[model samples]
Target: MQKKREPVADSLAPQYPIESVDNALKLLLLLGEQPQIRLSEATRYLGVASSTAHRLLAMLAYRGFVRQDPVSKAYLPGPSLTGVAFAIFGRIDIARSAAPVMRSLSEQLRETVHVGMLDGASVRFVAAVEGPAAVRVASRLGRAMPAHCTSTGKVMLAQLPQPELRALLPREQLKRITSHSIGSRTELETELAGIRERGYATNREESEEGVASVAVPIPTRAPGLRLALNAAAPQNRLAASRYPAVAAALVAAAKEIGDQLG
Candidate 1:
């Protein structure tokens, strides 16, 4: 039998350590490293008896921290854990951190600029700055839009692995925000493939009539979430001919925002 390895206590460790809490925390950390864990693997990892590992996993499941797949029977991060991660990102003050970069990009491009975070199948505009031009697109702050229908959302979605992306958008047909929105999962995947190759994404009046946008992903250290920076303008002002330049600007601004976020 393999011997159980104990965690080394440090200066901050409690005077009297609680093994169960320590083991549970270890499991959470393990989840961060892999996509899923089986009961047997957890038992082996915890160096505990099968029943002890089962009980720990059960308590974690009860608290909404982990869930077992009905088919695979492997434990995965649950909704509550995802919620906690978002809460931690919220405390990171992403909006405030991106504000200056958004304002600068808006001014430079003379178009509305936004910082958006991926939320499942949608993208939430966390911060926005409107352009000086009277005809520019309006701010999208605090609004959530279908991920496949907006450049901001698509850019962030492009960062996800294929399995995770498919998990998020399983149906063949997709909801459209406008006539221009991509209509099928296959079509969206095709475009996402191009987005991955080019390192950005675009929308031509997909989310709203007469509006166009280009977006680039904002690199983040966080494991579970992704973000993007976008520039939106009147379609006439942001034609396909301008996509390269607009995407380049968004990329630079995104890097700056990512630095601030860190």
Candidate 2:
């Protein structure tokens, strides 16, 4: 018989699966894959007693791999955990993970689709798929756009704590990418409020002269990172009256991407 190699500390040797570590790793995967998870469900998923699950979660939380919601008692993926995930799963992997789903959504909606990640006060489009149409929103891959004017930027900004938002955006005269762009922090704060309630964000020719778009967040393995996928078209095609339906489509695509990641 061939000799088995000794597993190193950073090894992924499956032959030496340690029970406790395996269970905890599985739990971490679930946390990374979903937006929120409850203790009861976690226990059921792992076929463990509440005490056992609690111990695992408590250890993870202490390590900053998990965060428990104060009001709902649900668990959210923590910043430290996200850092680990991002380190292990590089940026290209994230774009690769969402590619097929982005294509599907673009075809379904007949509009240009983009996957972007927040970079300070801007959004960097990592991947894009164009739609089948004579006139459409142009591909924005490899581009960084102002955060306050794009749908992707708004959705990500809406989730930031007030202090963080202020730190990133500031209270000074905001850049005027277009006449329709949010002109001040006061207006942006009000707009972000509505975006939080609606679970999606929209841009009415805010970033460009005549582009309209809707976007939804795509929760990733990164804890502190914010990513969004958006569908965009000309203002006339993606009219104000069509925002509701467009938002729905974006949300649905985001959900599918989440499920795919899981």
Candidate 3:
């Protein structure tokens, strides 16, 4: 006679997950069910020491799963998790779809590459790839910047309708980020017009003192979802003379990504 299945094995749980990982997942689930949690609460809930909970939260923070409030020291869910929901809902999956393209573009140009998403008046870097060069521009992941002063942002803004663009941007006092930043909405409109005509945009010490970038729009199947790909390097390395080649590389990568998304 064959032995009956063991009662404890009825659930078919995986056998290989580390105990700490299991606890971390449990903690993640707990965080999901609530608005926020403190470190002591995490420690108690995980039955680990304060240091262990801190380390786990640190790892999650690095991976963009959760962020801690500076004032309250409470942890909350992060933006990276939105990709999972977007994927589940059959959305464009921007970061996942653009990651390999960004990597390839960065490798080709030996410059930092970013996939930026525009929301309201801000540009958020959804994905970043670092070049092999030791002195390349730094990654801008998980940070939001004013849209009008960035190459990727211009690529996005140039596609917006005139009414929408006017509604989003202020008429004056456009926060000069640097000496190269567009000083007024009128100037920005002119700059955006050039970007639209050329099918790409360039940033020369606009967002930062020494940074320069070239960017192109990445067409997507999803409606009203504007995305851009950019290659950034130090101003001295990525000069006006190099913009065409860099823009070509970004455009090629954008086409590959758009084809995949389409």
Candidate 4:
């Protein structure tokens, strides 16, 4: 038997609250707890009339916060909601806690460092620190990029279970951001296997021209939390010969950040 899920607890009520707006916001928060919501479920959850729930959902759908599946008649997250979520998750509490460590890592490596989290098939850079070097890679905070094209994403993906990874990247033909980006899932899986064996991942002009990076997963204590630490620099500055040392440094820094988070 399945257990009934609990709704998120609310804080103190505002002095001038609107019922309609409050109901709509509750629906949005409900999405965070479940993959999809049926009209009946929303009605029951909100303890409101079916028609009222329908209207609220219709408005949310029109505004791109939710989209209803034609066949299933269930509401799922829309692009706008996803974008907003990614933006918020980029600056989540974990990112705040790891900022100083990430900054120190950038200063030590003399290269731009970033903390990225997986969001669907993309990686969202939550925090970044620019190196003091004059020609360093710039900060990528709040940017979402193709996961297969980045060391930060790849390192985290390599740690994900095969089923989850395949679900995130189901098709064989993957979208390429640059000429060097992996073009197929087969090739990406092969590289991921290597990343697993080496305990890290690397990108060499895969995400952008003349850019190179190394990343290791942050060992968070929280379950289902996937985050990585990466250091990026110019291809010449972050040469292949330096990968091992750079990767080692990133691994240590990632551990430090994780320990602090714990």
Candidate 5:
């Protein structure tokens, strides 16, 4: 007989000082929901005194569960949360959800397909499927490419608010990954504006020589789920004449993945 699954205990379970632990978890959840939250707001939300909230925040920060911005006095989630997130993601296997879509797109478009997510100032490829064509573009899993020079990165950037986007990449010392890479902030801003308008982005030999790609953002029901789906190929095969059709297919695949996620 098959075994039944057991209910998992909540992290805020009353093993420790229940009030303190609950307050800390509430603070973490609030910070996770917003891009940045002020200390006063946190204290108000927790129904705690300013000093008490500060002490709790200080303890959390000391343990690396959260971080405070000195200038804005705003709190944000720290490395510990990212560590937990990565651990959970490692087990969940987004590749399993994305693989068939990637394979189907690759087969239809005769180009490589990649599923990636924003990581700091870069896009990290989590999954890739190579086309059967002789002149295909191949990307390694876990490869990190600059956000300003890749289709997947631009799609993610387009979704960010101006302040968060500026905070993430203030200066544009964009690397020349290829001759076509955006070399300055102004150029990248232009490209990002276009991406926002079109709901998609493209890279014509911007991340690597002889490679071109188009991407669409994969929307999730909850916040902080950063992901995009892209189709890439050799520049010669993905010329302007062929870009529209490839882009349409990529958009369709992204929509399918988004629907599944929802």
Candidate 6:
């Protein structure tokens, strides 16, 4: 008779304060599930007193794990979470890993291709491939665009945890980069939601008039390294009528890059 297969067991389990950690995780999960959660709601969900929830959130905020809105008085994830994420990404050869794929995509689509990473309030292009087209979107390798405007920036923002997104962008001071730019936190949030559902993001004269772009997130094999691949062209050539094709190509490029990275 064949030997029975043994059940797989979890290794590297923690020894102490598993319950406390579990509670913290539960709180994080709860916050992540909602767009924003009030102190009372968190208290009720965690079965802790309002005072206790406040205290916990305070500690979390101090440690860079969570944040609270000043006006609405809600809680969300903090920059420290992204800090930890970047630490993981630092181990990989990000540029070397993304270059060939970007070049291939640019060649295939005949449009400028860019790879960007979220840096605080902006997305910085880390790699780019120039297309053969005579007229193309001109972008330098180190160009930074506001996260609230560009297609790559929007895609990166969409992948972030809700609280983290809120923490990065408060309700006030969402600027209008162009006439078409999103002017408020609410509108940006709605756009991000749609991007998440559609698996792509678009910028139609949002960052600059007569410039249109399409982008898709390049999921990293490691945590905290939010990256996106984008294709941009002059509005006359890459009009709204061409968005579907451009969006599909961008998504394919992102997936190809992601598979190689993974």
Predicted model with the maximum TM-score: 1
User: Model 3, 251: alpha-carbon shift in Å?
Assistant: 0.7
Clashing pairs in 3: none
Cα lDDT tens digits, model 2, 1-262, are 1122233689676776787887787787665445566789778877899999999998889999887766567787676876776565453465677888888888888999998888779999987998889898999999998999899999998987665677677666788798999989899999999999989899988999888899988865555667888999988888778888888888888877766665
Q: Rank the candidates by TM-score, best first.
A: 1, 5, 6, 2, 4, 3
Q: How close is candidate 5 to the true structure, as a TM-score?
A: 0.72
TM-score per candidate: 0.75, 0.68, 0.65, 0.66, 0.72, 0.71
**Candidate 5 or 4, higher TM-score:** 5
Tell me the tens digit of each residue's lDDT in model 6 across 1-262.
1122222386555666565556566666555444456778767776778888788778788898776777667775567765766776667676788788788888888889898998987999888888889988886588887988999999999987666787788676598889999889889889999999988899989998898899888866443457898898887777777777888888787887888777
Which ranges in model 1 have alpha carbons more than 4 Å from their true place? 1-77
Q: Score residue 248 of candidate 1 by CA lDDT.
A: 90
Residue-level lDDT of model 3, residues 1-262, one tens digit each, is 1122232555767778587787667666665455466788888877789999999988888888776766567776555544443454245566787778777777888889998877668898888988789888889998899999899998898987555576678476697789999888888899899998989999999999999999998875443356789999999998798888888888899999878776
Per-residue alpha-carbon lDDT of model 5 for 1-262, expressed as tens digits?
1122222565443455678877777766665555656778777787789999999999988988777666566766667776676665667667888788888988998778998888888999988998898877866578998988899999998886555666778886667787888898778888899888877888887888888888888765343557898888887777777767777888888888767654
Give stretches of model 5 more than 4 Å off: 1-17, 47-53, 132-134, 158-172, 219-225, 236-252, 255-262
Q: After superposition, how far is residue 12 of candidate 4 from its true place, in Å?
A: 28
State candidate 2's TM-score. Answer: 0.68
Stretches of candidate 6 off by over 4 Å are 1-78
Error in Å for residue 190 of model 2: 0.6
Candidate 1 per-residue lDDT over residues 1-262, each given as its tens digit: 2333445665476899999999998887777656677899999888899999999999999999887777678887777887887888978877777888888888899988888888999999988889999777888889998999999999887876566677789898999989999999999999999999999999998999999899998876554657888999889888898999989998899999989987
Q: Write the per-residue lDDT of candidate 4 for residues 1-262, one digit (tens) a residue.
A: 1134444477666789899998898887777555568899999888899999999999999999987776567887677887775565445586678888888888889999999988788999988889999998988999999999999999988976565577679899999989999999999999999999999999999999999999999875333456899999999998889999999999889999878776
The true-versus-predicted C-alpha distance at residue 57 of model 4, in Å, is: 30
Where's the lowest-lDDT run of ten residues in candidate 1? Answer: 1-10
Is 4 or 6 the stronger prediction by TM-score?
A: 6
